[model samples]
Target: MIRLDTGAITEIALLAAHCDDLAIGLGGTLLTLADSVPGLRVRALILTGAGTEREGEERAALESFCPGADLDVRVLDLPDGRTPVHWERAKEAVGELRRGGDPQVVFAPQRDDAHQDHRLLAELAPTEFRDHLILGYEILKWENDTPRPSLFHPLSEVVARRKAELLMKHYPSQRDHDWFDEESFLGLCRLRGVQCRARYAEAFLVEKATITFGGA
Candidate 1:
């Protein structure tokens, strides 16, 4: 288990457009948080993939990634590639998730991502989670080709391997694609890890945060 020596963050929500997006973007970080903070709850709100095989894959993947934690896997029925077409419904779905509780940290794709669905989700996050810290995960798409991510969450080698295993085990839809292989996951983590002097890491772009120099 990867132990992070830190205080517990109240909650964390991983918002993504697809099943593998959460795993590909912040799997390692999720692992670290769950292992280190017993109070931590990881909720994944997949904006798309509602009535598809991908949604099943996402459910299984989240269970494996966050064991013994509060895990809520929701698939908003909004059509893929048409989130903009149903903006109100999408916003209502997200707002419903943000109703009972608020997370200390929220993760979503960058607004500049190549995918229109991702961009729309990022834009919608702030509207519901205005009081929380928001971090945008970079999707390796054309628009985010040169993402200068400002935050790095280091991952141990073992956790990195677990991430790869979960990816392959849960998401079989992208197995044929070479880019979704274990090698690619490790490569990206290693590249980001270099910035933080760790064997592996996940990069994130921070939108806003409340910082205290010493004491809160």
Candidate 2:
């Protein structure tokens, strides 16, 4: 079990099909980055929930999740769960994000995700971020779409607890849902932590990565 450093990650890109997806998938990772890397720049794109309460929730949650980071986020009006129907618009949006900047890493959903919206974005993101490190994060929903992620971001017990707390506090709109509970969020971290031999951790599916040993 070798430990690796997330070297000089000054900027990152986050892609999600809907609001809260990024937070649910890697909220703890965001927190860890914000704490370790001061002034981290983050650019995020969500295909749905523009001009709605869900969008508002996302903005606030990200701010809290990535405290002290320069964050730019966009939530589009594309209809949720029907991403394939609006393929052109989604593709253009992703291209626009690529034009914005080149991030050191990209976070996205799994290409084989059960949810069509997640899957579509997962498939499309690589087209734009071809040479970047892209880590696929998983959303724990009703669908049996749990990913067998090879990469694990180890999280402290405190950070893990805060992720669950912010999730409950910021997204009041999602409170009605059964899965929107502290237990479910922390439980996933606990389960993944066991795999990585940590107190708590967040898992990521890595499609590709280039190792530069000894600083290349």
Candidate 3:
């Protein structure tokens, strides 16, 4: 089991095309990180949410999900479902955010995802963040598209359950939908955890990888 001493990571950034994309994709992982570290910083960059109802919902949800940490949220008014068309703007926005200092880790979508927006974001991310670690979180909607994830982080059952609860509590828009519920979220975590023999887990697809060994 990969027991990450989350205290080691001070800053984390998550990039997504929509409001719930980050939560749906890496909510459990984020929760685990927050719990593991006392002063971890987190940022969620939403490429869409331009004058939409989802924008307010995202704001509320993020505040609830990440309580103590410095939650930096930037909702770009870019057209939804058209990230590939406006790739330059997306890259520029990301570049502007990481100018002063870079986040220790960044989580974004896979380059070959079913959704064009996700794929585009993944492509643009590399342009700005060439040296840092980039993790691609998966969303199951468009299709059960799996990209052979290279990194897997196990979340405690408590963390997994809390992630689901936060999703339900924060997103009122999704509650009416048949798919948004406590059971399905837990089920997904359990299933992913099975891949690494953990009770609950979140998985990521990686475009590049680097590792250094510190003697145990």
- Most TM-score-accurate candidate: 2
TM-score of 3: 0.90
lDDT of each: 0.81, 0.93, 0.81
RMSD of each: 3.0, 0.9, 2.1
For candidate 2, the lDDT comes to 0.93
TM-score for each of the candidates: 0.92, 0.97, 0.90
Candidate 2 at 82: error in angstroms?
A: 0.8
Off by over 4 Å in 3: 1-7, 214-216
Please, what are the lDDT tens digits per residue for candidate 3 over residues 1-216? 665443268888788998899888888777766766777788778999867888988988777666677788889888877777887788888887677456888889988789998888888888888887889888766376766766678888878889889898888887777778888888878888898888987888777865557843
1-216 per-residue lDDT for model 2 (tens digits): 578776789999999999999999999999999998999999999999999999999999999999999999999999987889999999999999998998999999988789999999999999988999999999988887798989999899999999999999999998999888999999999999999999899999997987888874
**Which residues of candidate 2, in runs, are more than 4 Å off?**
none
Q: Report the alpha-carbon TM-score of model 1 versus the true structure.
A: 0.92
Model 1 off-target regions past 4 Å?
1-7, 141-146
Ranking according to TM-score, highest score first: 2, 1, 3
